[model samples]
Target: MMRITVSFLPSELLPKPLGAVAPDGQDSGVLPATAIVIDVLRATSVVSAALANGAKRILTFADLEEARSHAMGLRDQQEAVLLCGERNCQPILGFDLGNSPAEYDRETVQGKTLCLTTTNGTKALQAAQPFEKILTASFTNAAAVVAALPHSNQPIHIICAGTDGSITGEDTLLAGRIVDACCKSFGAKIDNDSAEIARRYWLQDEQGQSLAERLRQSQGGRNLDRLGFGADIQRCAASDTINVVPQVTARSPMEIAMMR
Candidate 1:
């Protein structure tokens, strides 16, 4: 049976391979599974928009300077490169673009390469390196992501990139939505308590609140609002609008491209 696991936060994720046992009787090594990384409040959303709108590829960096340096190097080679990211919920001062999905419109990102970094999203992607396949998911491309899942028995892990090292409701909610979809579409079974909790959370309604309103109440949403990004919250909360799934196509510089 296809098993699905959810990691509410990157820290909560095991050392990979779900249940692999090492020679010392310890859990270690990589998993021959697919990992979906969600950063609904922004990063993964941006990736979906950028790729869907025509960006050549997105290379993620955990460090702001590193991303800048890499973009500069690519630019020096006469390549179209844009440095994109955010710090403390605002765009980096010298970056060509911020973490907002709106900024990645086709006109700006088409045929260009993006070097991205962020507080939580990029870090979550780094932590998910142990999986055989890494895909980025957000509300914008949720359905596309579900369609990209492998039908084999290999486990599927969903990792949520919470806000600032803490669990955020937005990420968990998206994770739950993915799990719920997998269960319905792939007949996948929830593998653990985290997965079950996430699935339940996604199905719960809070006093008739809309998904966008619920996102505005999340920790990451509030941060973006405080920084004058209220519009971004609505855009990020959009469900399955983008028809592309951004998968990690290269790992040397960690590039993400639309799955083809």
Candidate 2:
């Protein structure tokens, strides 16, 4: 049976050998066959929007200056590149674009490479380097990501990019949504307590609150709202709006492209 696990924070994850099973009958050592990284508050959503809008590719970095420097190098070589990302829920100084899905329209990002850096999301992606296959997911492309999963018994892991080292409701909700979809579509079993908690949390109705409202209550959402980005929260709350699945195709610069 395929086992699905969820790591609510990047710190909770450890490199595991592929296909390894612990004495407790859980995944241990190197990561599983596939790993899905979720940062619903923004980063993964931005990747989905950029790719769907025809951006050539996205290169993620953990440092702000490194991303800017890389973008500069690409521009110096005459490559079409855009420096994109955020810090403290606001645009990095001088970046061409902030971490907003709406900013990555076809006219803005088409045929251009986006060099992105974010506080939590890009770090989560970097931490997931041990996985065999790495895919990015958000509310915008959750169904597409589930549809792209390989049909096999190999264990799959979901890594949530939490806010400031703390698990946030938005990422957990999306992770739970994916877990529920995988359970329904592939008959996969939730393999950890975190996964079970997320799945159950997603199944509950929060007293008539809309998805956007729920997101606004999350830590990341509140920060964005304080930065006057409530609209971005609404955009991120929309589910399955984008059909593209962004997968990590290269590791040297950590490039993400639409899965082929």
Query: In order, what is each prediction's RMSD in angstroms?
Result: 2.3, 3.0
lDDT: worst 10-residue window of model 2 = 14-23
* Highest TM-score against the true fold, candidate: 1
Q: List the candidate 1 regions with Cα displacement exceeding 4 Å.
A: 14-28
TM-score for each prediction?
A: 0.94, 0.93
- Model 1 alpha-carbon miss at residue 31, Å: 1.2
Error of 1 at 189 (Å): 0.6
Q: Candidate 1 residues 189-233, lDDT tens each?
A: 999999999999999978899899999999988888898999999
Please state the error at residue 186 of candidate 2 in Å.
1.2
- The whole-model lDDT of each prediction reads 0.89, 0.90
State the local distance difference test value for candidate 2. Answer: 0.90
lDDT of 2 by residue, 57-152 (tens): 999999888898899999999999999999887887789999999999999999999999998998788778878789999998999999999888
For candidate 2, report its TM-score. Answer: 0.93
**Overall local distance difference test of candidate 1:** 0.89
Q: What stretches of model 2 exceed 4 Å from their correct place?
A: 14-32
